[model samples]
Target: MPLTTRRRALSTLGAALAGAVALPAGQALAAERTPPVRPLWRAHAHNDYEHPRPLLDALDHRFGSVEADVFLVDGQLLVAHDAVDLDPARTLESLYLAPLAARVRAHHGSVYRGARTPLQLLIDLKTEGASTYLELDRQLSRYRQLFTTYTHGRVRRGPVTAVVSGDRAARTPLAAQTVRRAFYDGRLTDLGSTEASFAALISDNWTSHFTWQGVGSFPDAERLKLRTIVGAAHERGQRVRFWATPDVPGPARDALWGELLAAGVDHLNTDDLAGLEAFLDAHGTD
Candidate 1:
């Protein structure tokens, strides 16, 4: 079968696995086609699950990437920032996978209509990495058509690319997998050491590495360092991102965001979806 046909088949299978929550048959297909919305490809929704509608909110804001923190509870992948916030109802599948699967079907194989670029789903493991990732792997396997997959040294792109982040312990198991529906989120330490097939994203804490917090002018040396890091990662076909940056809405944040854009950062971490969306729009970076 052709790749597109295979994707559609898998999507139908995935919808069946999701039960009633899945989109009604032909509903997505029959829905009117909307003009392709310009997505802020570099906009990363930090703690996206905290938003009122999880994935839907980010999609509404045209964010190309969204992060969801998950914990392993009772053999299930629960979406939460911490253990205390865990709720049985908010599962990875319900909050992310199922919805994404439906959207892909709606768009006839892409998250965004008329666009083949995959939306990035950053899954941050909040519990023990190994166990949590094992559970995550199982969940992702069930919706295989919804995620980008690496199989036997080859990668097949899907509508959404799931990048596994947080919980360093998960690294071992992720590395051990010869085939998986998710990729690892690497840090600067893994820069050139890993391949783009495995570690597709290079993310780290901005505060831990830089002294500048988007105040005044970025230091000359630090600026060079930032660009160098981005350049190195791009050279290896991997993307770079940093969390813990000044997210406050102000000139400082704008300055930092501008600098990041200029430096070719792949994703900008922010809780303010509207803020980033507006910024990216104003700059015509979307």
Candidate 2:
């Protein structure tokens, strides 16, 4: 189907699904009961845990990717932006893993009903990488069936693909593992340095590479550079995402998002789930 037609169908289907489904924690909604909506795979929710409903909100928006910052305090992985704001009640399991497992089950394997693509869960580690990742590995093992796994040299697709971000030290343990439930989030420097099974995503700070904030014309050189980066990553079968972009609701954000889309960037990071969803809908994204 045409991209425009697919998006229109997705919007209508999504509206119906949202009204019909209630994704409460640990409860499974019958996704098969409603027609599936094509998710905005390029729409990524940055700081997704901060939303009123955490993972559920992103799902309701039909976003294919969501980011969570995790801090390892004591033994539990707590979800919070900063240590001071950490709430013991909010945990990685309660907030993300368990809920995702339930949803995936309801959808019959995929996170979205009738969709084959795995949902991207970008888990940003806030504490020391080595020790924290050890705990993370242990936790992810419990839900191995729910996550894309790497065993020996092969990758098995699952309902969700967890990519570990933040704290470069985590790479050490991750590399040592013969089998893992998560993949490493790579930076520009790591591009093409490792196989896609190891580094599935190439991410970097938007400000570090580009001066354009979407206010004016994008520099010809920078535009080329952006495309080149994306091309190089894609050539190696790695997806690309750039954070720290201007996310305020305005033309500037839309302009940057448009350019990123034009560049074939895989994920558009935004805290405003509704804004990005509307933008993608208006642009007739598939």
Candidate 3:
């Protein structure tokens, strides 16, 4: 073979090898350029303690938010939807706090894997508002190292956020307390009207009257209304959530979920975990 021809063939092989070597680096760069996956607004388990597995169910279902209604019984925070249903074995610490603490310790203090956003543990005050909250403050203080504390709208991770719902009277004491870990979930009416009374989220009941559904397009009037609510809450740096939404099969659920997403509602409340997961996945919101 001619020396020039041999030299040309060697150069071609060297160029091919160099291209092969650069491919992975280029691919890695492209992968890095791709935005990190946005964490899903979790499938919130409403009254999760009522479920057979409780914490296990929430974790298995990949819920980002979980709720437990508690009544202070004999100085123990017992989980129950109704005041009469309180069970001693189902203490808030046993059902939620302890497990969550263990998980946070395991995951280096975050709930979801690779998740920077803290999981939310909403406690609906089911007993007398004042004493219950006082006890709650004590119990939460025990796990203070595990809760996300916020003051003047700044958030930092410890374990999970404790949001108080249900008792309207709890708000006053909560606002008065100098302690900083727990936050209030207020009603929609309180959003635009109230002073910065220490609420981190506003949640309301979504009625059948709400018109927007996940169909071809969202309705303008309803969209505008929702946007106003979310905007007002966001202005105060408070997140928005809704409960009592239609849970049965079909478009009604989809419509509400769709509209909520479009309006940038912070949390989607649902008792049906599988349904919420499917809806979020379908809408590309999860």
Q: Candidate 1 at 146: error in angstroms?
A: 1.0
* Per-residue alpha-carbon lDDT of candidate 2 for residues 1-286, written as tens digits (9 for 90 to 100): 9999999999999987763435674444343356788899999999999999999999999999999999999999999999999999999999999899878766777889888889999999999999999999999999989999999999999999999999999999999999999999999999879889999999999999999999989999999999999999999889999999999999999999999999999999999999999999999994
Model 1, 153-217: lDDT tens per residue?
A: 99999999999998999999999999999999999999889999999999999999999988888
From the highest lDDT down, the ranking of the candidates is 2, 1, 3
**RMSD of each candidate relative to the true structure:** 5.6, 11.3, 15.4
Instruction: Work out how many backbone clashes candidate 2 has.
Output: 0
Measured against the true structure, the TM-scores of the candidates, in listed sequence, are 0.90, 0.89, 0.79
Writing each residue's lDDT as its tens digit, candidate 3 over 1-286 gives 9999999999999986753323377775784465444445646888788778997787766777888898888998888877678778889888888888766654555665457777888999887888888888888888888887765645665658888887777888788766577888888778876543367778887764355445456667777888998899988878888888667768867877777787888888777877887777778765
Give the top-scoring candidate (TM-score): 1
- Candidate 1 or 2, higher lDDT? 2
Error of model 2, residue 158, in angstroms:
0.4
Candidate 3 differs from the real structure by a C-alpha RMSD in angstroms, to one decimal, of 15.4
Error of 3 at 276 (Å): 1.1
Local error of candidate 3 at residue 174 (angstroms): 0.9
Q: What shift in Å separates residue 238 of candidate 1 from its native position after superposition?
A: 0.4
State the local distance difference test value for candidate 3: 0.77
Cα TM-score of candidate 2: 0.89
Two-way TM-score contest, 1 vs 3, winner: 1
Taken over the whole model, the C-alpha lDDT of each candidate is 0.92, 0.93, 0.77
